[model samples]
Target: MSIEFIYPEFEVIRNESRCIACRVCERQCANEVHSYDPERGIMVADESKCVNCHRCVALCPTRALKIVKSDCALRENANWPQSTINEIYKQASSGGVLLSSMGNPNPLPVYWDKILINASQVTNPSIDPLREPMETKVCLGKKKQEIRRDENGKLVCEMTPQLELSVPIMFSAMSYGSISYNAHASLARAATELGILYNTGEGGLHEDFYVYGANTIVQVASGRFGVHKDYLEAAAAVEIKMGQGAKPGIGGHLPGAKIVGDVSRTRMIPEGTDAISPAPHHDIYSIEDLRQLVYSLKEATEYKKPVIVKVAAVHNIAAIASGIARSGADIISIDGFRGGTGAAPTRIRNNVGIPIELALASVDQRLREEGIRDNVSLVVGGSIRSSADVVKAVALGADACYIGTAALIALGCHLCRTCHSGKCNWGIATQRPDLVKRLNPDIGSKRLINLVRAWQHEIKELMGGMGINSIEALRGNRLMLRGVGLNEKELQILGISHAGE
Candidate 1:
């Protein structure tokens, strides 16, 4: 028995008086929500088909279109909301696990909003960034314990392979199969221009991007997609993808529909085949096994590039990171629960991992307690929204932060949460030729560069206000942060005190 239990989620409104039947909306929308009706000589819409990406609304030549959430509601019940009931109904019909895109949209506690930053007052006058020399440059890798002098009395400066960034922000991993080639090109160009790095997300580096290897971080996941000796050696650094924030314990699944053309070649997989990365690396059964892989990668790269171990933030993340720090990895990247992805199971994305703020604080404290904080650099990410979030993250103890969702937004993502549909109208997340062409790499790269450059200025201004001149000075300075509306337990977990304390 079929049931019509719910109304359309989004309603489209068109002003007939203002509309001229130009049909620009029809051409721009990839979801086919609008169609021209020759019989009525007017444009018509199917509201049920709309994801409310605002593509049609943005491209409407007559400025007569708008999308709004439908006001219709189910019987008011706090115990079971409409979304919960809808998911149950959907699963009953489809008999498959519900899939969601991007980050968790549930109303969870956002620690970043609850935490606050402190500025210098008359006691310690704030430095003006314009007149003072403020440095945002950061290096990601292990640092020497102490300076050593040779027998000739000359200093011996020995350091591990490090990735130098002009800013403390980098574009997080977004695979070519999940996003488009134009999107990858934009990140590559932006990273090059910004003197930062962009990750490949285990999809393997495209041949065209080899020239940007200086600003690239190639990833090797359980799938071992597009992995080769040359691929390992081509990048500034290599990352082992142990887990992802969106699907903490789950593996990656690139559907057959998206595995075509260059995607198949880059992934080193057959066309029209699903690329499934197993939950755990087959060869890794313990921490020692992880150490083996880390050293193997170092050997394969001829000890020239740093090896990073990335794991999702979880309950025992501090212990996990502690083990990884001693496992020969030069850097550790921790991802939080709110991290974005092209597709993830709804259950895992919403309920699996902890917040990055808590994880970063715990890991930093543990590493410091163990006296191994300098063994590896900590790069934190999941949802680093702005320069303020970056400042907060560094104060909470992150050498650098990754910006995934923000980078996508810079490339015109409307966050419709329909990236899994493979019909991204903005051309940032789709592989369809028509949709892909909508994004010009040249313009996209410039926009990305502009975003990072603006953020660098803001970061400098924030640092200046704190009376800090360099990122190294601000790296683990938790004293510059205070908590608001957070309980003692929350503040303790974040290693910060309540505001006005």
Candidate 2:
């Protein structure tokens, strides 16, 4: 055996007693892991290609197939883990940067898990969500600091454009090319039905999805691909994606193989050509430069659509967000280091940015200190796993939360972390026609709706337990949060006290 031959990470186990040899697994697996061994008169698997996506197991009529992590190990070393050793071996052979999909799998501290929400005890009583009203609805945009009266003593009701969400959650950006057309269709349909919004990543809005424009936030990234006046005007809002949490400083890259037909036409790029976004927007070098483009987009959209500046949560994110707020952006979306992406360099994805909890709290405190808290709305993302995370984020000062990985999971993604390969077995991240057809938008959208609605109900219940009947009251209410296992510094940055105190 070649010394360089690393064992396959997963093993496919077939139960001979239950095996019908129907070849259903072979036909369903896009990775071609299963095949019929005609001579042996049984179906066999080449486990090397298995991503452990569970597609075959789900489709097997006899339930004979199962994929399990191989119990393979090397000399265990704390300084050099098995995955690290294997990565070195693979990189030595491939001579290329390692890529990964989905969110960081590193064992970093999740602040949401460490923080506990406060519930009513004596003075303030908890409200029953079923018996009383609870408001999860949120509006994302600039807010007036004070009410002004006209000469006739009438209040000024004029305000800038805002995104009205039925729940304090919106589906984050997942470009069409990075995902499947049916996946985008599912998100668009679910967002519209739920009275929220979905971002059209850097990929241009597909012509077919123009009908869902009311629930869309078209993005303008460094590449500015597929962006035009019509594209900007077709959405409820516009997002300038300065950076993403997964690959903070670097831009995006969609392999040419995935860019075919509508993906090419929508991105306005030639077919079979790599779509590489520049690291920085050549037109934006400073905050002043960003302000110019922000105003320009507003002008092009006739000042009707709200402009959002989405940035990764980095070391100086508080200062960066303060600048964005002053740059006339109606909203600032912060993505933490754990955020998901279609693909990102493994090193950057694991080690670049800060947690969204720290970033959101610091930015909110900074804005409030500067008396510009109401200037622009705050939205945070990067691994908002459940309704509890949503509630904690609001208490940490986020006006709303953007969910990407969670939304994709609702549409049948197994988090195999192989999306960059463009051969998703679940039909959520592939461009192949055969694979794409596996996901029915009708079913996908319905599942997404169910997931979000369930979260909304939970959000209301959490709020009711806090004696807070509205999300607006929960916003920036750090007093309602307390840390459990966090250190003093983390607790300070998160603007919360210890659980006991």
Candidate 3:
């Protein structure tokens, strides 16, 4: 016997007087949520199929539609929430592990919101960013422990390969198969235009994007998809993806259905076959093994490119980062729990990792205490929302910040959390030709460029208010920050004091 289910999550409201029966909603909805009734000559919606992406609402001609959460309840319980019960029912019926996309939706503490920035008041007056030169340019790489000089006494400036950014923001990794070609184009063009970098997330670089190699960071994950000697040589740097924030210890799986055409060729995998990335690199069992791979990449690139080790932020992140610093890696990228992903198991995404703020603070402090902080540059990602976040991340000791969700939003993602379905109507996270064409790379690139440019201006304004003229002066300056509503342990971990103090 089929049991009656709970209420639909969303309720679609369409004004009868304003809808005009234009059928625009019917035509635009990729989920088949809207249908035109021949007998009634009206547009009707199937709320059960709605993901609430807001595409139809935005495109509606007469402001006739709105979607709201259903006021339906199932005898609410605090300990066992409605969502938990729903998940149990879903699992029992389907016998499948629940999958979700985007960042963890759990209401975990976002430290950036708790932390407050300090402004110049008396001793030091704030500078006018418009009139004064505010330097935001940053280089990500190891700093030499001691300077070397030639026989002529002229200091030699031979430093390892470094990534230079006009702004302390970068478009984080989103692979080709996980997203569309147009999305990659947008990121590549924007990175080149803004003089920053974009990461090729474990999905090997497409042949067409080779021209943007100078601004790209090629990733090498456990599956080692799309990696080759030429791919390594073409990139400015190489990143070893040990773990991702969304699924800390889990592997990545790009379903066979999304694998086709260029994706198949680029990843060097068979068409319509699941591209599974093992949880751990078979060859890397210890820190020593990690060091070997790091050196191997450097050697493959003729020691010209710096290597970055990317790991998820977890409870023992400080200790893990310390080992990576000593693993011959020039950079360490830590993804916080709130970082975005194409797909992750529902339980792991919300319950596995720690916040970026705490991890960054602890890792920076540990590296400094070990006198190895200068050995590797720290880059943090997992939901850097605004310029304030970038400033806060730097003050907490990050060299720069990576923005995945923000970049996708710039490219027209509505954060509906349905990315794993591979039917993104916005064109940012789908492989379908028709849906992919909806995103014009030319327009997408411009929007992304505008976002970073606006952020750069705001970063300068924030730095000016702090009486700092360069990003270097603000790096790891915890005195410039204060925490609110946090206990002593949290404040201590973040290396900041209470807000009022």
Candidate 4:
């Protein structure tokens, strides 16, 4: 028999005398921190395996479990906060920036909560999804204004070739190097099976995943890692990631420790070198320069696949999105401040960018006013926690939704947010071979399918309840959405009145 132990940094001291023994801690803990043994007749915790995620500490009955700093102490420091002191120790020992993965776990405003959802009752009767079919399929790309026909009534030009997805949900950008081979395989396989798309991020596509090319969306970022002619043409669409939502106005860096072996070879960059994506495209200081890169990729690919330009939702996101729509980009993906990242500077991750809800609404309104809403498809991401968020995103003018952290959770990620250390216990986001092997692609892919299928059904239900039969009908249907507890400016911008008179 083998036993593994995890010495948690935080320890829970349970005062049994104060414990009501109601098992509230057991019920609240997703990790099963508190277990009640009938023989023992008391709640016991296996502290060695506890993640110190605070699930039980927050819900203990009678406040019996008082979470405290671990008794294990380091060299004392007189002048620093506990967290700062620990950070100094970490840097002194490893000389590396503390890194974390997934979305920003720090407390931030989740606009979805502040906003509200509406349902039909006495006025327009709600339709039941169980009775009839509802469509969640969404097409991503340009839509033409009016049709033109020749003398023979043949069409001159139609809408740009959009990627027809079976659902409005897509797997977000996660590079091969940031994630493992098995993880990539699972996403590719599941994307193919679900009739959705998975992004390759900027690390380029693995040769093994080329078989799933029909379901892939390859990325071309500032670093241009592993990008070649074949990488450009071998996907349904190409995304140029200008910035990410987690750290807007900042670039990305996949540290040297993670750049090893296959990840090294695939990126075509030197091993042990920090893979740095500069904040600004070196040649692009203006919108014209942005267009240069956009058209460059387009001409190189012969306009075969739709080009998507993804930008973080910043304060000026509306203007930026409008420029992208006119830059010959067939699609614009806006990531909100709450979006996840493999690694980001703490300052940037916590205090940068705008909410995705506001960004999506503002961008759509700006594009529509400019008569350019049909110029590109809009895909938004950043803490889209459930199917309800997906429904709201489409109604707010997004063509589709992108999901990242949720997908990882389905594949067994605990949201430990320690991916930057390259020592993830779960296989979802690390280059370490031992840790990477933990995720079995077959099982992971199946789980991903199950998650998406469940959400697909929920999407259909949400649409049916809104008296909408198809996803197309729900797209940009602001009339069906009325903001609650929102200011007048916010209501005006969202194009929906406040809920109730």
Candidate 5:
């Protein structure tokens, strides 16, 4: 029952006369829109699949690319808008919600680019990463305030066990219901191989993923989706997602249509009804309430896995982080404004929260001021675009970095940001069988490992340049970082001097 309809009224036309064939457009495009065909001797494009990401257009060497809305007209229908009719036609032909994944792919300010990464030269002699011993591994959890020993020289009080990683980079939460089992498998395998952890976002972990439990981070988001005693105890750490950067102050809606069979049973909600997560945690009304949950998790897990309270970075985040520090949370994960989402409302994604660099600097400073910095470890994310950002985060006070978009990119996500539509063509974010099978877990996991491994070396190099070998030295080493083009108040808040000082 396939209905036939023409697609993409808009088409990109590359003028060959002005084309230099530099292949910049091919290299830049994530969609594989523009590809070189040496036999034809000109670049070729798949106009049908193009979502107008404009990567090719932006990188064209000779200003040769232009996207044009097709002027070809159909039978005019004044009753319904042209777009409305076209959408219905498109759906009739393809039968999907225009699904996309990764982040809200909009033209928003990327603070990481605005900020800069420093390398050592004359003032700070650079240690060669090739020869020098660089330590980039980090553990996220509460470190014992004071190690106690008995008068008889026997060790006394115990410290919490942490999720130890070979490097500071980790995979963020992607729920089973939202993503496929294969995708989860890929994450699990990669995490196990990389000696880092992968988060099970909200969705309960299947029995199959238990082999990777030592490297798993179980999350408890607002919906309390599939949360139970066994679920809590099965992971190395637990994360309570208070908010996400892409859609701060707003919860998410996993449409009922996608909830089928196991997904329906696993979530414990009826199929064909909207699976909505409320904005606020029903039990968490204050710091006291937060403490209750943290202790409850501790009680359930026998005080083994550390409890993490994740919040979106927003105004007064420093103050809020101060409260979370006192709330018995062993870790505080901050997601900045640019953090990606599966299906956050477009408006919320663009307008909510603050940048990670600013938020990280402020939260670290505030906690240090209160002398509670060691109470909890910090992990921040929201468009941590590259290894440089990861290095910058560590220098700015984060103990580790959580990467969502970058991980998905390793899984072949193009960052179209239309995830809510649920028709992701790449198969990385969608649940449909035909499309989901497109992603090979073997290849996806390898790419993920590749990304994190590259980042690890770069992070180490940055640490080496700062005359530091261990990541611990750079964790709160604000002196290694100097503010450039920042205002007086910002510089004061970040506790960094202006560059060249």
Candidate 6:
């Protein structure tokens, strides 16, 4: 055996007493982890290939399979963990950067868990969501700072374009090439049904998804892959993706292997050509340059759609957001370090960017202090896990929240973190025809709708508990939130007092 050989991280245990040798596990796994041993009259597994995605276990009729983490260990060393050792070995052998999917899996402080929401006690009575109306609707765009009146005291009602959402949640970007066609369809349909929006990552929109344009937010990244006149005009909003949370300051890369047929045509790239986006837009070096693109997109859309500037949350995010607000952008979307991606350099994903809670608080406070809070709406996304996170975000000054990983989970993604391999067993993050067919858009869309609807109900309940009826009232209302297990710095940055204060 080679000295660099690393043991499989997972072991597949098959109960021989219940094994029927049906070959169902062999047929279901795209990784080819399971196969029939004809001579032994039994099913066997190549544990080395297993990603622990659970496709085989879920499909087994007899429930005869289970996958568990391997118990093997190296010499105990607190400074160097097994995963770290494994990564070093892999990098030494491959001489390449390590890649990962999904959000950072580090045990960093989750501010959401540390924060607590306040409920009405005595004076301001709580409202019953079941009996009373609770407004979860949100409007994302530049808002009017003051009421305008004509000479005759008549109200002037001119307003810029805005995205009106029934719920303060939108599905975050997941590109067409990065994820399967059915996955995009599911997100589009669900966004339409839920009266929300879904971003079209850096990948260009498919020709068939034009019907969902009203509920779509097409993106223009450094690559400018699928962006064109028609593409800009087709969507309700346009997002200029300056950076992503997972790999901030770095551009995107979609392997040529996944860029087949429609993916190639949609991106306007030749087949089998790697789509590598430049780390920076050649024309955009300053906020002034960003303003030019924002206006150009608005001009292309005939001033009919709002423009959003999306950036990764880094140090000095407040200053960055302030600049974007003044750059003719109608909205600013901040993606924190914990945001999920199809694939990202492991080091960047885990090391770069700040938490969304801190970024949102700082940006909102800075904008308010500068008297420009109304210049643009604030949307935050990194790891918005549940309805409670949504409520906490709104109280911390977000106009709305974006969810990517949660939405994928609703679509049946086991999050094996092998999206770059393009062999997703759940038909989510794959381009294979057979795997893509596994996800029925009908079922996927319904599941997404159910998830958001349930969240909406919970949001209303949360609002009612706080004695707040509308999202407008909850926006930037820091008094309704308090910190529990946080230090003075965290509590200060979050703009909320410690609990029991």
365 in model 2: Cα distance from truth in Å? 0.7
lDDT of 5 by residue, 1-501 (tens): 235556555587989899988988776554556788999888888776677655567667699998777767677887775766766776777666543345655565554554565667788687877897888888888778787899999988666767788998889878887777778888999999999999998777887887888899998889987788777877899888898877779776788877877777666678777788999999989999999988888888988888999999999999999999999899999998877777765456666678778899999999988989989999998888888888778878999999988898788776656555555555666677766776788988898999999988888777777678898878877777776677788777667777888
> Can you tell me which runs of candidate 1 are displaced by over 4 Å?
1-5
Q: What is the C-alpha RMSD of each candidate to the true structure, in Å?
A: 0.9, 0.9, 0.9, 7.3, 7.5, 0.9
Q: Over the stretch 1-501, how does candidate 3's per-residue lDDT look in tens digits?
A: 255375689999999999898888887888889999989998999999999999899899999999999888888799999999999888888899999999998888999999999999999999899999999999999889999999999999999888899998988888999999999999999999999999999899999999999999999999999999999999999999999999999889999999999999999999999999999999999999999999999999998998999999999999999999999999999999999999999999999999999999999999999999999999999999999999999999999999999999999999999999998989878899988988999999999999999999999999999999999999999999999899999999999999889
The lDDT per prediction is 0.94, 0.95, 0.94, 0.84, 0.80, 0.95
Candidate 6: TM-score? 0.99
Residue 192 lDDT, candidate 1, scale 0-100:
95
Q: Which stretches of candidate 5 lie over 4 Å from their true place?
A: 1-109, 122-125, 154-157
Best candidate (score: lDDT): 2
At residue 332, give the lDDT of candidate 3: 99
> Model 4, range 172-254, lDDT digits (tens) per residue?
99998888889999999999999999999989898988899989999999899989998888899989999999888988899
User: How many residue pairs clash in all the candidates, one count each?
Assistant: 0, 0, 0, 1, 6, 0
Evaluated at residue 57, the lDDT of candidate 2 is 96
Q: Is candidate 1 or candidate 2 better by lDDT?
A: 2
Model 4 ranges with Cα > 4 A deviation? 1-8, 12-98, 155-158
Positional deviation of residue 25's Cα in model 1 after best superposition, in angstroms: 0.8
lDDT of 6 by residue, 99-151 (tens): 99999989998999999999998999999999998999999999998899999
* RMSD (CA, angstroms), candidate 3: 0.9
Model 6 off-target regions past 4 Å? none
Q: What is the TM-score of each candidate against the true structure?
A: 0.99, 0.99, 0.99, 0.84, 0.82, 0.99
Looking at model 5, how many pairs of residues clash? 6
Off by over 4 Å in 2: none
Candidate 3, superposed: residue stretches over 4 Å from native? none
